[model samples]
Target: MRYSIEEMQDAYDEINRKERPLVAFGGALGGALPAAALYFLFAQIGGIFLPMLLMPAAVIGIFARYTGFPYRLKPRIPIGILAMVFHFAGCWLLQLNPFVYLLGPVCAGVAISVSKVKLSRVQEFAIGRAEIGKLGPNKSIQPTAKASAD
Candidate 1:
């Protein structure tokens, strides 16, 4: 299956429109925590490394749920990267198996890419509104009409 450049560009634009820095950060942390938790859980299991299996799904789910799922490569890339970095940190600090460093991030990237999930229009609106809340009230702008009249 081949995709045209226009299709890719449109997807990028759509994703950019939905992006909120705070939401992205929240999503990143949301995904990261699970991987960290799972890593610890596996460590308790005598280094079974089974927690790695859940990393991809957790990354995909948390990110998509928290951030507006634009189904574009750009948005998912950051989530995957964040999740991977978190996973890597956990592994390195805990001294998990060497292979997990490679596997964890790769699996997250693949899962996010293949998920084909997207945000509904209402969900997108809600996320945007929530983002505004996180940004705090808009105190930067004053009433220009009054000043002009005065």
Candidate 2:
């Protein structure tokens, strides 16, 4: 029932190896679309508040799916950068306050980090269950009946 260190390492490596480029694409698209929408809608919509609130939500939701999926940072960095660039571009096109540029990336970063933590915990739980399965059922404990005196 015992697994060697090498076996555990192999399992960990296998779990980390399943990387997909689609995650980066999805994350980038998630951030860009909302920013584009914000830029186009700013003047016509007549209010900054709604777009501001909705855009980050859209980015976070989109990027959330790809987090904690065993991908390397190389792909993810670009996705975040692309999203930030789009957000900055949107801000530039709208000529909104300068501070808005920092807001989007910061919010996105926090959301992504939180999502990664949550998902990683789920992965850990799954791994624990699998390890438990390898140990088989518990047989050491059995129910015992006490004789009653008549």
Alpha-carbon shift of residue 147 in model 2 (angstroms): 51
The reply for model 1, stretches above 4 Å from the true place, is 1-22, 50-57, 114-116, 119-150
List the lowest-lDDT window of 10 residues for candidate 1.
134-143
lDDT of 2 by residue, 81-115 (tens): 55556666666777877877666666445434422
The local distance difference test score of each candidate is 0.56, 0.53
Off by over 4 Å in 2: 1-14, 21-23, 50-75, 107-111, 114-122, 125-150
lDDT of 1 by residue, 2-115 (tens): 433344334444655755644654666666666567767766876564555555456655565556543545556666666566666776877866876776756666546643
C-alpha TM-score for every candidate: 0.53, 0.51
Specify the highest-TM-score model's number.
1
lDDT of the structure predicted as candidate 2? 0.53
lDDT of 1 at 47: 55
